[model samples]
Target: MGTNTTLKRSLGLWAIVALGLGYMTPTVVFDTFGIVSKQTGGLVPLAYVVGLIVMLFTAISYGKMVKVFPSAGSAYTYTRETMGPRVGFLVGWASLLDYLLLPLVNAVIIRLYMEALLPDASPWIWVIAYVAFVTIVNAVSMRSTSGVNFILVAFTMVLMVVFMILGSIQLYKGMGTGTLFTIQPMFQANMEIAAVLTGATIVCFSFIGFDAITMYTEEAKDINLMPKAIALTVLIGGGIFFAGAYFAQTLFPDVSVFHVVDDTLPEIALYVGGVVFQLIFLSGAFAATVASGLASHASVSRLMYVMGRNGVLPKKLFGYVHPKFRTPLFNVIFVGLVSLLAMGPSLELVSALINFGALIAFSFVNLSVIGYFVFKKKQYQTPKQVFSYVIMPGIGALLTGVLWAHLHADAFIGGVIWVATGIVYMLVMSKIFKRDVTKLGMDAADDLTG
Candidate 1:
């Protein structure tokens, strides 16, 4: 039996990209288009443009940290190494909400898609099936997970491309809205700028999967290839999202006229192709949700494995890789079990918590870049280095911080409660008053290898 405890470096650049894209789920643009259109008043494309700009800087900051501390812990490692172990632990604690709950969100989304396809089917059935599917795929091996991601991403992208093309052809034939291209979709005459920026915040969720790429650093074949992979993932995901929103907007230029904002794409599909195309769209969407669930489950398991191996959690359980499969089998099962939350909670509530956790993690990444390069290495000695390392990260930190501050009130409360719970656990389990848990956590890293 193969007994390598460490994760194997089995993934190439494109494999990492596929994993990232799968987690992002390009079809989600259609899923959220109605909300985006209503919020932006037909300026969905512009909102995505703003989201892309902000995420690019954040992606750059992530690339910087990946080069310096390449590990599976991601934000936890970056924050702990640069700031301190205590702060790192808290960041990990907060990020746990994001990674843990995201699989549930994707699984629930799968159920939602299934319900739309077969109104008579029980949502719980789809939830159970997807959760089980995700667990089985991730428990096998990273290669198996990545292989599934590649195929799902490929199929989803082809369907999205077809949807866009058919939408364009319908618009050309003067089916609805009478024109194929119009500047109004990007900029409405009387809409407030704040509305567009708020809409951008909503759209920002679509760009989140890029940073998950860093968790694969331990398994990537070429470490340097990670930065390029991160950039490409964000670019490709953003491009797909923008195209979906733009075309949907063109087909139905007036958001106020949309009977139900949430069903915008389904409505558009009905208009453009008929019942057959709507089924195809729903099938593509369901496939994307399954792909997303698999990716998120795999990521959360790896995050737990890294933390567990570092002694941040139970090393014996979380740290143990399957001797034969070389996968974090226990961690995978743990994440899958957590995804059972899909059966209990509303999707909106879980999504709010995810936004809070992910936004904070993004802010921490920017801060890590500043802590490492500007304060530690003193890269400020040169003008070019100062701008690239210091100025850029500073802007990134500020932007992400703004986004965090503006998070929905419900999300803020949910995130704060989760963090408070972590603090309590830290103090109790780590015996903060009796022992130096922070130092112990840092030292625990010496026992393992990447």
Candidate 2:
């Protein structure tokens, strides 16, 4: 008899939350606080607040879409069902820039953190070790990945809690700005909407993991729980990010005075606590980075597996799962091979592309909710439905699209190149766009019913 060849549903809401937190990497607040502070002109929390509101709408939209089409393809499946396969393929292609490059970004960031603690160690060694370890974890099982995430996310949060307590003490003791709770960090004189929105565009990258929850649709034990899981993941991740930035800003109010903005957290760790606390915080961040990479790698592997099963790629390769582990082993290893780019040149430039790709996919996902509810289902008659399906997602799309427009010109060029490359591949595969992509994708879409 032929095997089912379907992904097994073995995950619950808590595991999903852990994976989302792992991907969001709450410790990233340590990594980006100074940069966002500088970007927002000392209004770090304000930037996060704005990002939180915007992504909440986007997250709600994701929840709406996931309810209609729960699959491993996520944005790809949502767009395919609401729009068409060609557009879906392109959206999925754009999302690939995020899913594929995120691990590399995490790896590079982890290498930097490792260098701070172990200056004598080679960066390649760190990168290779992280890549290998995460690849193995993802290849073995998502449950294993989730187990690691629970521990890593818990440890990451504990470090943040410690930082918050120490920052509060420093504030109480009249260190730094000498204020325990002030709106100064939330706002600055002469700040403009343009500046805050610009800062929000940058901060929005931190909110990308919320949608990763949808990638586990096929693997989730209860489909109804996914919407709640996605919302909870976003809300929880945003709260952690907001709290971390708030406390860090309280500890280090002036970003300009820092010796190095990128390494602000560890330096703050030294000031607020001591060498011991600094090492502890850095270790937490390192663990968080690895956890984030592991979750990202696992998500992208499932994406490739679904795409392969849909015949968008080579079915025989990406569609294969390890019989024992029931994981997308080949796709996981392929992501590992792609992750070697972290050791290559222009890591910053490559990492910069992630925000744009993610924003575009988010915008499309928001639009997909509208397309599904209003266009396809025609359920926009009621006030609640109209608000949820139309107005909110419209704002989500417009805001995310504005952020995408504000991205670096090079990112735009690179996005265009990436999409163009996908288009070329589609043309080649379809014999100059002669084949019917809708029929092809729908056939696989139908498989979801089984």
The CA lDDT of each predicted structure is 0.81, 0.82
Provide the lDDT at 141 for model 1: 85
- Which 10-residue window of candidate 1 scores lowest in summed lDDT? 441-450
TM-score, one value per model: 0.94, 0.95
Across 1-450, the per-residue lDDT of candidate 1 in tens digits comes to: 222477889999999999999999887776667777777777888888878888999999999888888888888889988888889889988888899988888877776666666879777887888888889988888999999889988999999888878988898898556576787778767977777876677767667789788888889998899899999999989888888887877887766655556545566677778899988887777778788888888888888887877778877888789987788999899988888778666555676678788878888998999898888888888899988888898898888777676666788898899999988888886684477768646555653223
Q: List CA RMSD, all candidates.
A: 2.2, 2.0
lDDT of 2 by residue, 152-207 (tens): 98998888888888888889999867887888878777877776777777677678
Candidate number with greatest lDDT? 2
lDDT of 1 at 183: 77
Q: How many clashes in each candidate?
A: 0, 0
Best by TM-score: 2
List where candidate 2 sits over 4 angstroms from the true fold: 1-4, 344-351, 432-434
Give the least accurate 10-residue stretch of model 2, judged by summed lDDT: 343-352
